[model samples]
Target: MNKTIVLACFLAVTMIYSCKKKGKESHPEVKVVFKKKQVVYQVFTRLFGNTNNNNKPWGTIEENGVGKFNDFTNTALKEIKDLGVTHIWYTGVPHHDVITDYTEYGISNDDPDVVKGRAGSPYAVKDYYNVNPDLAENPANRLEEFKALIERSHKAGLKVIIDIVPNHVARNYQGLTNPDGVNDFGANDDKSVAYRVDNNFYYNPAESFKVPVFERDYKPLGGDNHPLSDRQFDENPAKWTGNGSRLSQPNFHDWYETVKVNYGISPDGKKDFDELPEGYENEGFRKHFEFWQDKTVPNSWDKFKDIALYWLDMGVDGFRFDMAEMVPVEFWSYMNSSIKTKNSDAFLLAEVYNPSLYRDYIKKGKMDYLYDKVELYDTIKHVMQGHGKTDNIPPIQEGLKDIEHHMLHFLENHDEQRIASPEFAGSPDKGKPAMVVSATISTSPTMIYFAQEVGEDGSENAGFGKPSRTSIFDYIGVPTLQKWVNDKQFDGGKSTEEEKALRDFYKRLLNFTINSSALASNYEDIHLYNRNNTEGYNDKVLSFVRWSTDEKLIIISNFDDTNTYNFNLEIPENVIKKWQMEDGNFNTNDELYNQYSSSLNIEDSKGIINMEIKPLESFILKIK
Candidate 1:
């Protein structure tokens, strides 16, 4: 049979089985398959277990304590797993430039002028082979400590993911602990040229690098009286800034702490590297790796691939690529393909904001998932802030229908503001409805930042770290999350009643997401139907349906924060026909809140649902 006819026959069989009796002994057994929905919990490694109550602005490491790799004990990992998290993204695990002194451990001290804060920017990686000394109980055994943490996470049924900042490195990049025969970046570069395919970085040979001039209330080392805080950096033949700024003296706003890596892409948008074959997308990563074995590619690509494989060998489950779009897609195609060759199940997530480049990065770059920041995330934020309507969601889903599974959904991460912050919705309650929609609207994985469940209001004034985002650049404790930590108990002993309730809600939602078979099945939008048929159903409400052969769910959310809504939601005829439902009265139970029970009347191949939804409430109604 032709491919189209084969697909039609397969779908027809699926529909017939979908309408089978629930527990009919006479019916033949049919296996139901579902892609497990993943819930990722991101924690800044330095701050996750820090019990420091003294959060002085720009405080020294001594004043403000830091969490060590050993802090993620079995108890801690178990708590996280119980919260229904499948993956733990350990941010800032790699050795980066920090203001703290680690010279006693044979590590070089970083200049205060270039570092962002006392802890420094995690993206400005200084050593790829070594773990951060600040996170180790014993500085010399840092790598071992991290490996142990990875084992612990895996023991608790959680996978480990660390950052792979391929686009840039610390200005003073040095791999002192590199394995034998491994060379540091720029060591073999011919620095005279402005750009070279083999050179690891772009150099400006004519001028020396100057430190950016600090403005406003900011200063080098937060105005602390340090000898090296003289606004002078020693770099002969300055390199390009991480943000692609070519000026020898980059502005303070530019990514001045790090230098961009050269990936065979020229300054004028020219590609100097080999492109993937036209039919390469259909091939496996092992094939791609074999294709590059004999080819002479850029030296930087080889180095990154080796780094990724090293982590994979050490039990690291995956990597979250930083600013992946900034680097060339062809290089990612080469690098990520090599990573998958080593471990095919390795989760490769990229941060790519440009919508136009989404498919190119996923298909050509071999990325498993990319942040849905510019579209779904931005739209959800706008609706939460009372600026946009719920009608914007269905179109976005339809537009990315082919690639929705590849687009990872998240309400907050390291780069975004907290939901409880003044700049966002100003309260954690506003996130309930948004999180419901973000988690259930697609088959994509959902990520929640550390302390997001208990409402960590990122309102601290830590040096070099502004409010609205937990300071990744400073040694600071998250207030709300600290309560749950309760000084390393990993229990909510000190959390307020409301905070505990919020965390419980998150637990329920995330656990349901992972266990729900319908989440990974077919989706049908019911927003337009309810808007047209149900009176008093405003833009604040959104509804959809997800169904598989064995499971069906009607998800509805009320985005409004003030008034409760009572309306009759109409289920479209197409959805009823797709599910092969017969005309009758069906009983439905809310899976989210089991106390609520309702009846759906199916007539004329359509259904009407009577719902009395509270403000910011959501329902996952299971049809019976």
Candidate 2:
């Protein structure tokens, strides 16, 4: 479906309130236009506002203070919005298993052996109907505090997105706060059989669950003394691990902390649930919901659907599904279609890396967006590492031509290595050119992890998770981001000069992307044209053109970190004729540097643009 059509439908359904005219010469009714390009800011909830400097490897929650739901004040949210953020993905919001005890609040204790770290893995969801108690001011009112945060985010003109780990749940699955009439996962399962169409989890009939043997210097509870940390968990029939490992004792590298949810797929990889009828993709969510009303499907599907609707009703704009491909695409089709029936504009993004399944998930699964990791992100990383060529980028964009707009672009997220870490680029400066190309190469949503602006190298040894990627499993504080937080000031007062400069560059680039009409319009790759026409243009340089009815932009980037390139970029005769450019000299201004300007000579229906691009720099030239 076209985005314009979707937006129009959403507006028609949602725009019902009209302003009352109270006086003569009433103020002109302002019209709001949604931008085609979106910017997502992903922040790990546990560490976003923590100011503690203690980052011990396996530190307790007391040793490293956790950021509360109230930490995202209006001032902080406004600051984030000013950075050109349209949506704030509040990661790790759902109630998950943790080492801390919340038994006083009617929550059962989670054994440390089944949890990942002191804080536990956010992907290992414990309860679908409650918010993480560690994030609330009062453990009794955790859900209310989260609802208030959602309201605050909307008031600040930003949408809220939270994670939905539908593929799996914490090993010790317990839904303490489920709504009335809703049964927990596996509540009606028969453990005697290993496969059942209506069962919630896949069982190992005769095997008992065993904790994975710890290697290296790690222990089940990080060597901490606790009665429940005896390396034993009670499960009569061991369920499959989150990663599909059938072993009763999963290896340390496996996703041992989580258990896979069964979605009516039998042990031999056959789907047993009722499939959506042909031509269902073109139908609306209401139609899909009505179709499933009387149909008998797996119990797990209904449970997940209820969980999703609950969050949507609580004012969350959308969800970011974790490991989405692991679940059956049919389930997503049913769930997401139902969600769209409630709110057509809900931003549904999934983490799907398989290129083969990308189209299936987006079209058949009813997902709005999928991560562009295997192609765009990996290509950029290779180019930044100096082993790949810019020539590889144009083909990727061409390959995903039909669904390019549905691909979400990002350099860093919760699961990926930071751009400035030693395992990646080793410096944030290397990401400047790559980021520019990533943002302007297509009309997709771009995302940035928290503290990526100030170059947060996730180098801490935060228990279960090592360096490179920030710790999502431990009680820890991000080093560089902590300075910017500056004890809740959110002003970056303690940032170094280099750090501030890096952040300013990101701010300028992201803000420009959101406000530019050409970027949100049409894209045409000029890399092949330049590589063919220009003599000195190398693989280290990339160029493209973005245009709309009223504006046109020529974007060029130098991916090389230590060399400058001076070349005459060429515009094909076909493009010049399409734009109806007259045979005359045109002046161009750089939107990125503002101080740089160059002349473009158009003769005989062809244009020659001269550029001297610095190392790791990009130029967004506006035709005058």
Candidate 3:
């Protein structure tokens, strides 16, 4: 070969290598750095209350008038922002069915307190584009209020995420229902009426009909069912007959009660009926059905794209999808694709309760946030509540890895029980410490549920057709059980020194969790360092770690019942640096301690490192 040609080839090779090296230098390791932002605060439709001793089913942001939101905006949100929260999720904004007949769900309309305030669970939406009247500034100026709220949130530097329920429509929503039995737009209410074969309703294999098996007991303490205290729900549903009784349904299903959507096709190459005849053949019905077949409802795909774009245009940051499993993967694909077309920063967090189903969406990049139920339940709730042992740590660490790659982490959400409830019932002395610790120290995107700030120990499962006073707050807005939350010292309330210390610990923990560098970057490499505990106090200590090529954070949560702990841990030989203490102390070791001790000492019985977590608390020792 000629020297000239060889020299030219060498130059080309050198340029390619240089570009590759530059790329590696700019972006080293697959680390997803979490921006130093506050854990997202999620507000539910059913939880908001007023000073006038009213806990109506639903109300508008504007109607609650400045007073209600003032607490949320000025106090709650301010605290959240101060603690470094990055986003907020406001669920149930759309219109829902106002069920006048409470007997349908075992609720009695008799209680004068059962005021159906203009709106219901926003999930039962009559219109997606319009905000519920109760949440509006005035009936006519609702959208403006939403815009203003978004503006306020943005000003506070919080990304706002609205909930989108696509799986089903409200059972009794107006405009969609044709009173004359003939659907004006061919949108039927029949369960079997499906537009496509894939849209068929889920049927239990054991049962002959298309229904799910639900437990009768609403609250069972230990099992899947929660006990039902409501008197109206005593009758068995299996014994009851429907309009056209083909057979008695022994098992429970997500039927019209929680209407299941038709994704278009069935196993038998048929469409599940909404309310009309299966495969209805009519020019009007076919045309309307075709329109409904498209994912963007109330309008065409182009229009739906515009709706999503409109929110983005308003500086809205993100969205949290409800029952995302029911939505066609194509809809999410289109949403993610279309969203990227406009802005890259827009985040999408889907509420897919099942992890396996969630992964499908995550792989498609359909969402950036998801409910980390596995870790939240297994590690935080179970461990801190004295329900889990040290053995549970390994699974939790593994679960965190799966969740970290594709989710914004959160603790209890609207669908589940409240964190402060007896289920996670740590004593005001014990639980609060663990609660604050777990909320802050995790690597995935963290979230705070409504009423969590004030430490409201409400039930996680409220809407199980029960009339119980165990909600986030009582009817008369005295903030029943408010002591569980109020950071007494900060709020100028009279709390003991220990209580005050616990409250301050939470603030500090929040600061450290969000600002940590190692946690922000390669969290997967972080392993569960030490989950060892007192032999008899296996139920107490919940310890773990998050480390990468550069740093490590050891999290220890003790949920013991006044049991002092003294344990040993095996640390990685390379891990030497330690910084910050939960008790307002910071530590540094310029001279590295080059040793791999099989057992590290654990003197403090309960307290999160860096945040000074107290009994029933969690902490992180930042090692970098």
lDDT (Cα, tens digit) per residue for candidate 1, span 284-332:
4555676777778889999999999999999999999999999888888
Error of 2 at 577 (Å): 2.0
- Each candidate's TM vs. the true structure? 0.94, 0.94, 0.64
Query: CA lDDT of 489 in candidate 3?
Result: 19
Per residue, candidate 2 scores C-alpha lDDT tens digits across 207-285 of 9999999888778657889889998999879999999999999998899989989999999989887888887665445
Ten-residue segment with the worst summed lDDT in candidate 2? Answer: 11-20
Candidate rank order under lDDT = 1, 2, 3
Q: Write the per-residue lDDT of candidate 3 for residues 1-624, one digit (tens) a residue.
A: 333223212211111111112223321222224444347777753334333323332322222221222234545555557755677887665545432232433322221111112223456545455554444435456567777777777777778888666565543323422223323111332323222333222332333332223456422111322123122222111211111122334234323223344444343544332322332211111122333343432222233345567667867787777777656554555565566546656767787667667655654434656676665555655655666655554565565564453555555566665555655553444555455444544455667675554455553222322222233211222243233224321252534465455445545655656666555543321224443322323445555555544555565566765655554433433333332222222342211122211223323322222222235544455443
Model 2 superposed RMSD (Cα): 6.0
Q: Which stretches of candidate 3 lie over 4 Å from their true place?
A: 1-34, 45-49, 54-76, 99-119, 174-258, 267-307, 399-403, 426-442, 459-503, 523-539, 547-552, 574-614, 622-624
lDDT of each: 0.88, 0.87, 0.45
How many clashes (backbone atoms < 3 Å, residues ≥3 apart in a chain or on different chains) does model 1 have? Answer: 0
The prediction achieving the highest lDDT against the true structure is 1
